[model samples]
Target: MSRDNPTSLEQRLSVHLQPLYPDEDPARMAQACLEAMELSPSATPVKPHANLWSERDTVVITYGDSIRREAEAPLQTLRQFCHDHLSDCISTLHILPFFPYSSDDGFSVMDYTTVNPALGNWDDIETLSAEFKIMGDLVINHCSSRSLWFDNFRQSIDPGASFFYCAPGDADTSMVVRPRTSPLLREVETPDGVKHVWCTFSHDQVDLNFENPDVLYEFIKIIRLYLEKGIRWFRMDAVAFVWKKLGTACINLPETHELIRLLRLLIEHKAPDAVIITETNIPNHENLTYFGNANEAHLIYNFSLPPLLLNTLITGNCTHLKSWLMTMPPAQFGTTYLNFVASHDGIGLRPTEGLLSEWEVDTMISTLQRFGAKVSCRTNAQGEPKPYEINISLWNALQGTAQHGPDTWQYARFMCAHAIMASLEGIPAFYIHSLIATENDYERIENTGHFRSINRHIWDADALSDALQDTGTHHHKVINGMRRLLEIRCKQPAFHPNATQFTLHLGESLFAFWRQSTDRRQSIFAIHNISDQPQSLNLSELNLVSTDQWTDLISEQHFEDRVAQLELAPYQYMWLTNL
Candidate 1:
């Protein structure tokens, strides 16, 4: 069926809605959905551009208050900082959840429609959106227990009375999957009776009942409002556990995927340039399902990259990393991966289910612990505590190798990881802290009593500006190095998000890959020495064209002979390209 046809759209909506709402008339519900989106049945479908993203597109994820100044809203300060430093390299800004919230660092949303007054207002977001494509979180899975919706539920009022999911106290929920070890059901007193409301992440975050169509309608309106405010990229945060069934694992259910498709359909119809990104921190195979024949998420987070990359750099071996990369299928057009080494949260271990062995994971965890990283755990099906993620900044995580312990190659190793990420066939996102090479903030962890707080350090804007200007600090060096790489990457066609990528069989000590532009006009051999010892590679190994000149994009060095030997220092990487 043609997606642009009005009749086909209605049919598609009905097909997606039937499984989700078996009792309702799908046609009626579909019409109501169109009404909610303020779209007519015959409205022309706005076709998305052929190239939604490109090599020039890079993202930086940061909290609104990550860099703060006195007597000014944090969003304003963030805007000024990005304009001054990131405007040249970064094309998008992912301001993590700026909505009014009760807890969980803006995840537990209190009012989805209003911006957090502490940060700024919609005007500030609109202004920032004008300068850069803005990515906002659609915290669709749950809401704050202190929200008006939840409060109204307690009073048994309209809208909220049927908005929350509740089950009996003795209901069996042993098969449910969640990232938190918190109790699945939270006891609440309502006018009708005592309710055991579902809490996927924490007791303070009450899960919304998507079984009720009203909830879906509410989110559609929220998406519309965000588009009006110029937020083109929507990050569905913690979306895996949105739907639940009694006797099955709650995460990644088919109904959840259907909901995503419905949202994607509606969003694209409204704003052709809008992008829907799913934040599912699950196993590799299951995470791939979010692409859904190119009908679901426009971008899925490369969840396995962080832990695997950390292991590769720390152990000086790319056997596992190479194997995993070789197995990954390139993303289809209209969809790609969002690759990153760090974010506001920790390095999720769940995505490493089959990629890394138990011993390898334990060893990596222990090594991170030695570098002052904290481990967060979740309850498994057998009710055993297991490591969920490692909470530490990227700079601290790469302080040294597991064999040699902390060393002087921290700076080089850190840059090597990012360089490899940049050269991969995907859009690279940098966390604000990682760009500045911030260390673990144990002080924030102690203050908040949360392990993730270690990586969520808030910087004073003036102090950070001074550090960047000093040039002697690692902050200055890391940011400058990142900018240079991104600037160079943006000009290369081989680095396009959907470019062809093939893993190179260099060695365990060196990780390498070949990327060719879509039009076959440019080729790049991205190689990195992950070991602490110097490594050598014969230029002939790459089979470079004898007639065509080749150059290292990073150092601008010319390779005169195909058989010439190239020496790479420890933690060094090269982008050998033929333009």
Candidate 2:
């Protein structure tokens, strides 16, 4: 425990454990943690000098069961697809919730130790990890009521009864911030009697009680097991609601942050190169809190990006998006935003609460509805439901614009959106559905009775392959366009996660920004025309270097002569670098 040898695992564990378990013996707890760490599997080697946050780190967010075939395991097909198509462009595979689950896709985990048999086993995950960096969802907030832990709780077992939050049937829960209209306290039949348990998302997904140190220990053991299987990246699903307390909002609470910090310290202590990204789809101000004094999440999801991008493209105005971008919190020393346009979930509207006005949000919602998007709502503190997210593929969400139709024009607009996303000052991530230009799946939604099914599409491997291989299809075009942008982005030092960014106000319909690398050796000026018609840009007014020759990294086209004023085609973007 001396200063010179500060990294002794026991000392580090003592420091973290003492804060959470002050009354418990630190040595005993530390020894128990060491034993848990020792039981975890050994990690497979990745790259030697790999940095978790880098321009080279591009994540493809997909479900383990996203792709399927007639006779083979879905993961096998997925691994083969990544190798065949995405090996060159994507750096990490963020497979969302592959664990054995009862509901909510894979969020309602029934077992943390095993993968769903339909998706194959841990071997498939290891196979995928052997090729690319893998990210697994640590669904730490809640687990299925049917899980063994919950079953043990129902049987009044010691550790399992303490694993979840259970209160008297008449406990006051009026102050809880509700993300859904469902009752906060769900009645469950236990051996002792019927008790009310905390169910944040749904009745089946029981919230874990972190006030009990054993719950934290259980999650740590699960994470260690994942690390041993070569999962270097973990998306802490619904992490903001992990530690709940009555008479409070129960979201982003201090104790929750402490838990995150503890997990971060332990992960770093064990696997120095591992990453933990928090998935808190809340308001912009509250979401960033997960980066707890640089001790929590390695990356926080940029929830504002999806809605803001849609607003900019739909309204043909850059005011809201640009204003928010300018005021965005600067990326700290070891953390950055996980900039994404879409994911397995819908486009979150909560992040834009203060940024977009009520009228603006309504207008955007109506526009998306016209383009075949569905809106899901969440209850406010006063119990009135409001729009929380838009359920549709990002491509379709941007398709309602009058500037472009449903085919190539939509693809061009989609490419324009991603161009800005990649050029931003953070690691860019793409949802698998977005990469292939999928639209809202109305049939799936009707069949499953799941509102989010609109954005979650299951593809047949052979059919998907055919579409991707055919150059004329929209799927082929979108995938290729995204790949080209990602390839260009990964090679640019200015796109580093810790780069300094400055917003450039070109016009109402023109969105632009400049990224200067940490080393100052590279600077990139990214400009986008969100309008349906061509827009003229004046370089002099923006105080840019008035150069006669400026080259776009994406198109590789040289702009000569009239560099002071240039025209951008409808839904076009340029990553310009001065030579």
Candidate 3:
């Protein structure tokens, strides 16, 4: 069927829905899906654009209330901060789950249509969206147990009576995979009888039943509402575990991918430039599956980059990092990676399952623990507790190398990480805390009794402004360095998200890669010394053209001799380019 034909809209919908609902009438469900999207059957469909993102795209992830002031709303404060400081570099602001919630910060959403009054109103979000692209979380896998939908389910009422997944007490679930160590089933009392509800993350967050068509319709309406409110990017949180079967590993089911394709189709038909990003923090191979044939997700989180990059800097060796990079397949057109070193949550270990050795993982975890980091655990199939993620601030996590304790190379190491991320073949996202160089908030963990809270610190806007103004503090230095790197990155056509990338072999001490612009008009050799010791690089190794003038973009130094040896300081990086 031709996607450009308006009649094929319904057919495409049935193509995705039939596999999900084999016994149901697919045509009727397709009509209902169109109704939910507020689109008529004959409405003109917008064609998906080939280039939706570019080299200038950079994202900053933060909570709605991450920075607060005395009287003004946090969102307003955040808007002012971005306009004043981040206007030149950042292109998108991902406000993490700004909805009313019962637990798990904002992930356990109580309502999907309304913004959290405590943070701000939709007007605040709309105002911010005027200056930057806004990314919102769908939180598709689960909802707060205290939500109105759950309340309806408890009373066996309409809209949500059959909204949640229920299983028999004796159902086989030993093969299920989850990130949390919490019990899988939560016993809830309904008017009918006692029912065991599926709780993938925690008992307070009940998983939804996608097997029910109404549930899918409800989220389609929610997606439309977000689009009306200026949310250009939809981050599908914990989407991999949305479908389940009793005796199988409940993660990454085929039904889930079909649903993602359906959502992407609906979203793009309405707004051609809107993006759908999947947040699957599983193993690298499984995570890549979210981008099925360039139809499912517009972007997938580069989950392995965090642990691998962290290990490279901490261990001062790039053997594992280089190996992993060489094996990764470049994303197809209209799809790419969302690269980041840290976010609201901890650095997940699951992505390193196949990339790093057992001893290497254990050593990295121990070193992070020595630096005052906490480890969160999950239950294995055999019921053994295993480390799931390392909970620490990015600033503190890179205090020193594993071979040697804390050292004087912290600033250089920190800046080097961002340089590499910005130069990679994806849109680089930086957590707000990382840009400010915020340390782990042990006090927050003590207050909230959650390991993830260690990295989720609330900053006072006044104090943060003062800290950034003081040139002596690392906060000022880090933000300044980040802005400089991003400014340089946005000007280079070779840094486009879909540019050609090839891993360069410069031995384990130095990590290098070559990226050429899609038009082939520009080329950049991104080289970094991921060690504390100075390293020498022969210019001949880069194969620079003798006719063209070569220059280092970072230091703005012109290379006069093609064969001259260059010494890089500890944790130093260079963007060698020929314009």
lDDT of 2 by residue, 1-579 (tens): 753344555665577677677788977877776667662223332332234677788999999878899889999989988898889888999998888999999999999999899999999999999999999999988999989999999999975887998767787777777578888889878787898899989999999987787887788899889999889998999989987777788888877787787777678767878888999999999998888777788889999999999888877899999999988988777788899999888888889889999988888888888888888888887888878888888878877473343434676788888988888878889999999988789999999887799989999999999999999898998898888888888888888888889999787988999887878767788999988879998755544455335678978987654336777898999887764
Q: How many backbone clashes does every candidate have?
A: 0, 0, 0
Model 1 regions lying over 4 Å from their true place:
1-6, 46-49
TM values, all candidates: 0.98, 0.94, 0.98
Tens digits of per-residue lDDT for model 1, 467-571: 998989999999999999999999999999999999999989999999999998899999999989999999878968776789999999988888988899999
The lDDT for every candidate, in the order shown, is 0.93, 0.84, 0.93
Off by over 4 Å in 3: 1-7, 43-49
Q: What is the C-alpha local distance difference test score of candidate 3?
A: 0.93
lDDT of 2: 0.84
